[model samples]
Target: MARLTVPLVLFGALIALLLVGRVTSVQAQDIEPRAFSNAPIGVNFLIAGYGYTRGGLAFDSSVPVTDPQLETSSAVLGYARVIDLWGQSGKVDVMVPYSWLSGTAESAGQPIERIVDGFADPRFRLSVNLLGAPALTLEEFRDYKQDLIVGASLQVSAPWGQYDNSRVVNLGTNRWWFKPEIGVSKAVGPWTFELAGAVTLYTENQDFLNGGTRAQEPLYSLQGHVIRGFRSGVWASLDVTHFTGGRTTINDTLNNDLQRNWRLGGTLALPVDAHNSIKLYASSGVAARTGNNFDLIGIAWQYRWGGGL
Candidate 1:
């Protein structure tokens, strides 16, 4: 009986590993912006006009169910600066978002009020460049024109906004989150592509909604951009971004993972002056399961107002 039980346990463990890989496949591939090389003691601002919608969610062994559709709009002003510590190449990023919303919905058959307000959340990041621009050779020719940056970043969230334990659209989380990230980017021809990923760790949330306790879940995203420079210092690109992730645990127990979220969008670069440009984009939430899904649109403006050192 003991020998039979040992084999069965090993089989079960193998199955669990396969399921875990399937669920985290997309989460490990998402891409995000690399703040290490973008800012070095300069101030850049990001203005976001975004929305979200959630209708039905499909969880483990469960059918799809209708959920509320909520939407919101907001503007985020963020700053990224390079911090030189220990004589290494590192940087930090900070963002404060002021949001507004207008929508009404019913959750569990109870009506909920719409909201419209402004709030702030701070993000901190640190990175170091490793092997800046590794050499590549092809057909007896070598190319080493640009720098390739690979670094790690850590971000934290602060609870300083209006949040009610029963409100789903609150702009804040009462718990702290830590995310470590890595990325690589380099310019080739007229296009520049960037790859980045981050995994988040959730601290204890005594005030989590639904009286739920959750575990650390890693979110994955990936993006690619093909830019072509036109006359007059203007450039445009077709940017494709893919994101996928779900919750890992709830109430200190592994619950059905949250529904995965997917986004599709495009960006157009508009040059304002010799050292300034603005980006406009719009994205749609393709499918959602655990909550309402909404569309998102936003604009970002960046300008270089100082030295090129």
Candidate 2:
């Protein structure tokens, strides 16, 4: 036990230092793009290393129960590209994400906890923008001093990760899920506000683990930001999610009981260059099953570069 302490402590300390630097050097609300020129083709990449502190289970109508603190972490990478349209003002963007999860969890009264490590399910999303800004705008609409933009998105979860088939923290569900959503954005002066919502259609999971079931899911998000000026901005965003639609079937019998969960978080962004940015965020659950309430702290560095010829 003592032998493992040094590495874990070092990792935690490093992340802590980064967070401190992010918080003290600048305020999250002051980053912004100086110009809105559309590029013919563009690419963006994001890398995030996250830590999850609490681990527990929340069942229908039951308070959450915590066994032990399961220190888990994931390294996620995403890539997106813009498809040129007309010039650069309008475009289509598609992104893919891959991640790895590792950690250990212990029960409250249990003497020991188990180690968890595996690849996460891959995710894909596509978006198409209409009436893009800073590139092309209808003369009539432009006169209204309105920065209206609309888009649609489709996302899918592929069951391509490693799975224990009996544990809750597996990489794949062994079943596929998909979602469709619409988004709207507007800019007023130096502020930009966005709203998006989606619904998930769940498929049957014959081998669902931990007495799990398949169900429909709903997600909604709202983000608002004010760019104090170019290259700096303070932004606030909130997201809400709900899960319910599947039956708890045990031994071919249905247990009408359903499970639900939710999360909310906010972040501040600062640009280090034309293609690089830094963000600091803190999140926690408001109301959740007893074992479901936990807090999260994170920092992300993003870079946008390269694109199609």
| Top candidate by lDDT | 1
**Model 2 stretches astray by more than 4 angstroms:** 1-40, 44-53, 56-69, 85-113, 132-146, 210-262, 289-294, 307-309
| Every model: Cα RMSD to truth | 16.8, 11.8
Give the number of the best model, judged by TM-score: 1
**Lowest-sum lDDT 10-residue window in model 1:** 18-27
**Local distance difference test values of all predictions, in order:** 0.45, 0.42
For residues 1-309, could you state the per-residue lDDT of candidate 2 as single tens digits?
Answer: 865755444332222221121111111111112112223235434444343434432111121123434444545445444454543343332222233333444333334444655655555655555555333332222233336766565666666666665554444556666666665666777555655555555555566555555333332322233322232223334433333333344445554334444555555555554345566665555554334344556566655545421
TM-scores of the models, in the given order? 0.68, 0.63
lDDT of 1 by residue, 181-212 (tens): 67776666655566666666656656656666
lDDT of 2 at 269: 54
Measured with C-alpha atoms, the lDDT of residue 282 in candidate 2 is 58
